[model samples]
Target chain A: MQAIYEYLFGAASFVPHGYCLAWRPDLIAIHALSDGVIAVSYFSIPIALILLLNKREDLAFKRTFGLFALFIFACGVTHLTGMIMLWEPYYGAQGMIKLMTALISVITAISLWPMLPKVLALPGPSQLRAMNERLADEISDKNEAQIQLHNAYSQMEAQVVARTRELQEVNQRLKEDVQRRTLLEEELREKAELLTATNAELERFAYVASHDLQEPLRKIQAFSDLLKREYENDLPEEALQYVLIMQNAAHRMNKQTKDILTLSRLSWDSIKFASVDLAEVVEEVEFDLAERIEESGGKLEIGDLPLVPGDRTQIRLLMQNLLVNAFKYRAADSTPEVKVNATLHERGAPGTGGAYVELTIQDNGIGFNQEDAERIFSIFQRLHGRSEFDGTGIGLAICKKIVENHNGAIEAVSSRGEGAIFKIQLPTSQPTRRNNDAGRNEAI
Target chain B: MQGVTKRFKVLMVDDDPEDGVLVQKAIASAGHKVDFQVVTNGAEVLDYLFTEGRFTDQSRAPRPNLILLDLNMPGVDGFTVLKQIKSNMDLRRIPVVVLTTSEAETDIVKSYDIGANTFITKPTSFADMIEVMKSLKKYWFDSAQLPVA
Candidate 1:
């Protein structure tokens, strides 16, 4: 049975049914190879399209390019499988046909390898055009947004300009207001100065007028008193007593007027500075008041005094007045020990740069009440009666003025019937002090 | 007046004309024949001395031997005038006595500093003024040497 079948099929089964189908095996092999080639080509085209679509990322291209190359080689394998299957059967009978089929299939598959990458380079034209249109729309939208922002910037610029103009106007108004205020202040200051000057002039005129008036009044009082003294019996006693009272009042007025004139003169003259020796001045004062000092039994001890810069004669007057007061009001039976001492007090104060020479005149005299200490320096202020202590009542006031003229201060510390210490602090060579040095001895 | 050095010429510089008249009377009362030249203020004193303004007749307005300077004169007080006269080399030779109402010690010292021959407080009593005038005659004419022009 096997022999009969072999004769009828003419070795078709043994050689391969694919070979019998071909009058030429090469043609048959060509046909079989074409099937695998077409399939692999179609498959490779899809793979290349996927690779191209995913080629944007560097990592995607690295992974996908290798797969694409492998796909091409896989296509080559389909043709290789057909050629190998036909090779074993036709190795002796039709070797050229097998070899030729394999060679042609391989050449076609290999040729498709590079062409697949070129065919799938980018997307189709319609899809790319659609993407470009979408991108153009997005850019146009951005441009519209920029135009809106530019309009907003212009509006903000207008607002800023308006704000700047408002601020400038405000500044101008403020400057004008300041100028007006300054002018007003200047006018006010000038008016104040004029008022002060006018007041001073009026006071001076009044003083002079009253002082001159007193001279004529004095002659009247003197003549009237002379008439009363000369013709006492010729006039009534009541009339004589009235005339005496009138004379006394006139004398009091004269004294008051003289004191006022003296005070006015002191204020009118400006103070000046010069080298003044207090020791010499005190010695002269002692000589002048020798009788009073001797009669009162007051011991005047003037110690070493520093020479300072001041009005010399004024300081002399100051010393004279203070000494007179001490002698005039001595403690009963106390021997009236008046010690005049001066020492440069080294305060070493900040900003004062050292010492202040203070002339202290302390006296064991019949001191006044504590209340009178401050009041005694005032003009026409007296603690005692004219009968008890004869004075113009302006002595201490004049003393204060003289001391003040020397840029010095006089203060009295006293207790009733105990004693009194008058401290006179005068600034030394203020010329040597720096600009900022307000004298330490300026404290009154 | 005959025995005394040929009736001394006197110049009184005062702000008040009435005061000037009073000074003239006072100078005349001493029995000395004093040709007293009166100027209203310190300005007139300068005008008379320097022969400026109204006082152009230099020879007619003879230079006075004594100047009785009242300190409170207007338009240039006696102090200012005194300072100018005492400092001037041409005029400093003349003796100046400061006659003013102020008895301030400072004024007294200042007058001496500015070359004033003497500083005398104005006495309220005319009798005291006469005494001052007598002393002035004794000191300037009898005691001190009088400068001859």
Candidate 2:
């Protein structure tokens, strides 16, 4: 131990390094300058490494860099020992510094060589430039894709707006159509109400004509008859004739009033609809007027008849009036002959509705003038006096009313001394909600 | 009416005075020996039937075996009076015959619907009126087994 300590600090027994240069002043001076320069260069490199390590602590092989700095510092110390030995005979310290430099160099090489592949595995400048170019291209591609996505989003929003606008327009059209339909329905309801009012008025008039007005006529006829019967022997012949004439007039007036009432009672409101076979109705009417028809020497020629939508009683009344008219208006020379037939008529006009059943009643009777054809359907439109044919001139009028009540049309064509042809068109099927109003027809 | 001795009481309702007089005369000649009474309005009919007001006396308001009702009147019409009489337990048994000058179908149907035993359209002729009265007496007083009043 004493020897090793003497060797490590053996400067007391060693000569100065200037003796190895044989005491040549110029050589020693040159060696000292060279070592001084090398020492300063080595120390400056270590300081630069330390400064780089302090600033870039994240550099790879940081411990290896510290080892490299220690190696360089040891080399700098050896160079300084060389420079110091030339002046201060510190050969032991110079050799120890050289040994430390060698040891530090060995450690730096051991650490640095193990990490050589890792340090070289880092990207070179050209590879980093290529990666930067590739990342730039990818960024541009992403930017383009984002632009396309934005355009698609905008387009989708625009389509939604257009669709919303179209739907709004359709909704508006539907709203307008609904409003128009509501208005049309309201108008139809108002017209129906007006028709009901007119029917009520007609029923009231018929009631007054049938009941109140007939009472006075009845009383007139009754009182006059009683006076004539009770005072026949006491009264004068002319006075009795006057009473008889008055009674006859009253009776005629009463018949006229009753016919008017009948015609007016065929109001549109009091219609009860049923599927009535016209043939059956005609048979019933014929049965009712059998005596009259036989007395007039009239014959009925009934053809195939169809079932019509109508009130049975009203249709019977129609057939009866028409048949009576035929039998009553017969020629004085020739007997009456009546033909009744019905035909199916399809595709009627809009005013007449869908389909129709056309009935024709032809009669060989004494006919009226052409101008009176239309007027025959009017009330109290008699062609002859009451004595000629005992009628109140309301038969045709009542028939027309029956036909009109059944949503039908009636017309007559005739000539003087010729037969008459009556055409009646009726709807095949009646509307279900027909004439539902209960009219105010009261006995006065 | 052929062999029975008890006289049948008949109540006639009429608005017209002449018509009432004619009915009374016709009933007199009907030969049924009917105790006939006449009232001008439907109120008097109820009054007489219920024996109220002036007809509170039993002698004045004798219950009739038959009631001849006039349909049309100025106040308390025949329909209202008939409804009351038919609904009443005491007066419902009496056979009510509705007679009216107005021979409308509505009046006839309403009369029958209101429980009239017979609906008679008043005849215009006096002879026809006499015939109606005779037939009414024969049907009500003789033929029909009416509830005793």
Question: How well does candidate 2 score on lDDT at residue A40?
Answer: 94
lDDT tens digits, residue span A1-444, model 2: 878767766778778878888879899989999999998999999899999999996887788888888888888888888888886776666677888888888888888876989979988889989998998999999899999999998999999999999999999999999999999999999988888887677667675767678887877877786787668899999999999899888888887887777776666347667789999999888888889878877799999999988888789888888887877787788888999999998868235567988889899888888888999999877789867888887788889888877778998999998989899988887764345346332221
Worst 10 residues of 1 chain A by lDDT: A432-441
Kindly list the interface RMSD, in angstroms, of each predicted candidate in the order they appear.
Answer: 5.6, 1.5
TM-score of chain B of 1: 0.90
What is candidate 1's TM-score against the reference? 0.58
Runs of candidate 1 with Cα error greater than 4 angstroms are A1-17, A20-42, A45-55, A61-64, A71-73, A76-268, A331-334, A348-354, A402-408, A431-444, B1-120, B140-149
Candidate 1 structure quality by residue, lDDT tens digits, B1-92: 32264667778787766556545555555555666777878887888888888879887667778888988766899888998898788788
Give me the overall lDDT of model 2: 0.82
Instruction: Give the best candidate by DockQ.
Output: 2
lDDT tens digits, residues A1-444, model 1? 765544443334455535556547677767667856765775677477566666646443443444445555555555555454453342332344445545655665676676677658766688788878888888898888888888889989999999999999999999999999999999999997787677567657656865676656655564564466458899998999888887777767777777667565555554456677888999999999998789877689889977887666567878888888887786456788888999786664224545666788888888978888889999778888877877778878887876665556788999989889898777665543121112123332
